[model samples]
Structures are given as C-alpha cells and as structure tokens.
Target: MSLRTQLTEILPPLLPSNPSEAIKGTELIRLARLQLNGAYSDASLRYHFSIMSCDPASPIAKVEKGQGYYRRSAPVPALTGAQELLSLSQGRLDDLSSDHEAVDSALERLRKFRAVVTRYYEVNGRFPYVFRQAFAQGASLGNLWKFPEVVLVDWETGDAPDEVFALDPTMLSLKQRLGLPPFRLHAARLRIHPSLASFREDFFQALSASMWAQGGELIYAAPVEDEALADGLRRLNAIFGVGVISFGLTAQALDDLPRAANILNAHPRETEALMDRLQINRIAAPHTRQHIDWQSLDGLRRESEEVQHLIGWLNDCVGKGRAEAFRDEA
Candidate 1:
C-alpha cells in the first residue's frame, strides 16, 4: 500500500502500552516518520531573508555600535508540526473503529490523575511530588493529558506486605535502567485508538518523551496540538469521585486544593498521618509510584462507569500481558 494509505490504516488505531510497546510499534514509527517527512521540512513560504547593508556609523552609530547586529533577525526555527501527526492518526483511527468507550475512559483517567496531583498540593502544602521533582528541573504536568498513575503510586504497593506482587519484571528492569519507578504512568498511560481492535506487542517498554517547566519546576510533557494547556491541570478538578481517600475533615477539604494544602502544610503531621486515616488502597501518592492496581480499580469504580473502566483495564492489561510474555521467555 502507499505510505499515505498505510498511514491512514495505522496511525489512529493506536493503543496505549508501556514505553516498550509505544517505542517498538513499527507502523506508528513509520507513520510518524512519514508525517514528519511530508509536512515538516521545506514547507514554509520562502521569506525575504537579507542582511541590511546600512551605514554602521550614521545616526545609529552616534548611539551604540553593537545595537545594529541584534536587529539582524532570522526566520523561526526549522518548523516542526504535530497537526499532521495527530490528524493522520485521528483519521486512520476513525476509519478503523466506532468505539467511544476508550476515549471516555482516557478522558476520565486524565481527570482523575489531575485531581490527585492537585490534591497532593492540598495535603502537603506543595505541588505533587512528581510535580515537585519536575520543578527541580523546571516543569509541571500537562493539563490536557495528565498521567495520574505516574504521580501517585511508587514502584510497588504491598497489598499483602511485599515479597509477591503484580508488575512486569521486564518493565521493572527497563525502568531501573531509565531511573524511573515502574509505576502507574508507565503501567496505565496509553496511545489509544478506541476503535483499534488489537494492540501492538511492544508499546510497554519505550516511548518518546518531552519535559516542560512551570512554577519553577520540571514535569513530563505529552505531545499534542494545544500548548496553552501547558499547566491546565485545573481541568482535573472537574472529574468526579477521584480523591475519595478517607481522611475525615481532610476528606471534607479533599475536594478543595487550597483547603487540603492548608491542612497538610499547617499540620505537616497530616502527611504522615494519612495512613492512619485511609485504607491501603486509598493511600495518597505524590510522586512517581508505579504500583496502583489500576486494572482492579475498575471494579471499585461505580457501576455506571464500570463498563468504560473495564475497557481501560483491558487496554492496560494488554501491556501487562505482553510484559509477562516477555518475562516468561526471559
């Protein structure tokens, strides 16, 4: 098939996987390369670029001699656009399926992750730990596609008190290699196309990434069209039933970022006291913890949301299964 048609067939039918799956999807890599090649290079209208040969010592010379060179402006950087990338993917995905369940699931999870990040501020009187860590390098979470799992759970949660657990040994190794916790973000984030019938086996281990800055902190960045959502984490507040962790009056204030932060900041003890106030599963995470059984979380969510929740679970578990497959062969 033609590259364009191949792109139309593959890009949008994407599914989320761990870094490995994302990176190894040959079709997506192919499409990304094509989209970049077709629309990115040498597409801009040629602008009249010239160095002005003005008298360096006229009226301007009377003021400052160095001021002239700063005016020798040049065109913008070699242009790179994600529109074709997103559109090409979107078009291909639209043709392949009619499911909205995955879209809703992703949107809801995005919302949940946002709330948790904000709640960390309320509970600790500071931004979420991952946010803080990112800030150390100058960044913040993307508002549009927040990966809640990454910021909340660490590498593993001991539901039965350590020893045995539910994580991909293969993934854990890669994460160790990359200096990241093998946690929720890697486990739950997806490059999903709701209509895509199957998944690529390699998405879980690798993917491209960018970093950003806000409030003097560093955070992970997601690729997309809108840049304004740079810090639009506030959109997360609109998601319902996310931070249901039981913390008494803290729960009362849990819905409010400022109020929650006030309590945590005022009584720094509350941060540590959280375990006493909530269940193991309700544990609050502020950094990149990898262990939240987001797959099981679907069972805990309300019945109305269960269908979509399960869809998300299935999408994520597909990666886990692949990771396990890799582990079994290892």
Candidate 2:
C-alpha cells in the first residue's frame, strides 16, 4: 500500500481527538510503523505526515501552534459566508442527522452556555440581554449579521445584588452634556468551540454585529488551550478591537450543569459555586468607543423588536435614575 494510504488507515486509532493531547510527529511515526505495511524511512514518513495533515480529507491533522497531530472532528452545520452556526434553525437541524436526541443535546448545551454567560456577566456587574427571537427555530439566517446573541450593558454607576442600581444623576447629566454615552454597550457572540478553522468568522461576526454598539466580544464556552488558536484570536483582536474570552467550560462540563432556567435564576451562594467552576481567560480586551452609532442603532430598532425593547429599557432606566435588570414583558 502507498505510505499515505497506510498512514490514513493506521492513524485514526492512534491519534488523539483533543488538540491538547495531540501526539508529537516522532511519536506518531513510531506508532505508525507497527501497522505500516512497508519499511519506510523516518524522514519519508514525516514528509507524508506533513503533506497529508494539510488535506482536510486526510485522517491526520497537524496542530497549528505546536508539534503534534490530532483527529479533526466532523464539521457543524454553518453558513458558508461567516460560518455562523445554523444548528438552531429547523432546516439546518434536519441536515444534522436522523438522531433527534443528539440534536437536542447539542442545543441544550448551547442554551446552558448562554445562561452561564449571562449569569457570569450579571454577577460581574454587567447587565446582559439575550436576543432569543433572532436564533429561535425557523428564524432567518441573516439575523446573525443584524443581531448579537447577547448585548452587555455597562452602567456608569451600579452594583449587583441590588434589584435596581441607582445611577449617579450628576455624572449621567454631565456625560449627556459632553456628548458621551453615560453607559457602554457591547455586543457578544457566543460559541461552544474554539477552532483555528472557524475563529476568523467568529471574530468578524462579533465585529459586524457590534458595529452599532460601543464594543464587541466573542465568547467561547470551551477552554482555548491550543496556543495557535489563541494567538490567532489575539492578532484579530489587535486589528479589529473585538475582545475574545473563554469560560473554560468543556461540553461535558456544560452537560453537568443545571438547566438553563435554573442557571439563570441561581441564588447568591449557588451563583458563587458556579463562578468557582469557571477558569475564565480573557484572550483580548475590546476597544470601547465613546459614542454609539445612533443611525445604525436606529436601523436595528426598525428591524428588531428586541432592539426596540432594549432601547426602551435603557430609556426607562435613564428616566427613573435607576439601572435595573431587564424584565421581559413578552
């Protein structure tokens, strides 16, 4: 058999699926020889490994920022333009498979992660509003460009635990007079995985989704352990100003958590326990602009009822002189 063919056949079982646990090229070569049909030299085998790793169809994949190889998992359903996850859409879910249970589980994980992120930010003093209608089943795919999964609101003065935070009236008035927004708004895109292949889309989507806001964030549920993936995110952040963060929750970790509703309503002690589980990593800090794009925001208000609600909530807070958590009336 050809060396490439031999490696492809023998490598699946030998390679680790997790990028962090990838086997070094030397170790892989040694293991491959046991099942390799012919007596190939180490250098020739290494060359084949390098060449085959670059091919997506090949069984082997070289780690981007390190010396090792791993097994690439199956691709998720996504849009071709930005590779946005379409798993929430009914049409795309049908394309996933006949196994409905697996689909339900994947979606459960996504919701749980979103709940976790919302609560995490809430505890940290940032109010988060979710755009549920945008990603609901049967929702339009183009919503990815127009709306972020979550919008984080940073008040000029506020505290957690209090149902309502008292805004500093003088500061708010001063900021309004100075032509500066009294609060900061950041749009965030959340995902379960951090992959070298899909991160560019993730970053850009966060950037595009936040064009109307003061800043943007790309948050991942899983730990970004791969050095190269982290480096790529940093480089993109440096150029584009969108922040990147990882919550350090693996798929299994998310699965172990309580239901999304339970997570969102966790009490102080319970919330603290949940926070202890996170190994949060801020890959990059987002650049905050002093002014929001009012025109772009107005366009969104016309297209999205959620955006209208958000603006209404903000206006109510400003008028009442208290920054409070958003309560959905619908």
Report the number of the highest-lDDT candidate. 2
lDDT of 2 by residue, 1-330 (tens): 787877878999999998789999889989989987878999999998877765546777777556798886544454222122362221222254566677668778888998999999898888999888777656677777778999999987744446348887788999989988788999998888876567777788789999999999999898876555677789999999999998989989999999999999999999999999998988899998878999999998998899999999999988998888999988
In the order shown, what is each candidate's alpha-carbon RMSD?
A: 23.9, 4.2
* Positional deviation of residue 79's Cα in model 1 after best superposition, in angstroms: 35
> Model 1 reaches what TM-score against the true structure?
0.19
Number of the top TM-score candidate:
2
TM-score of each: 0.19, 0.82
Regions more than 4 Å wrong, model 2: 1-10, 24-26, 32-69, 77-97, 158-164
Instruction: Output the worst ten-in-a-row residue range by lDDT, candidate 2.
Output: 82-91
| Superposed Cα deviation of residue 202, candidate 2 (Å) | 2.3
**Any residue pairs clashing in model 2, and if so which?**
none
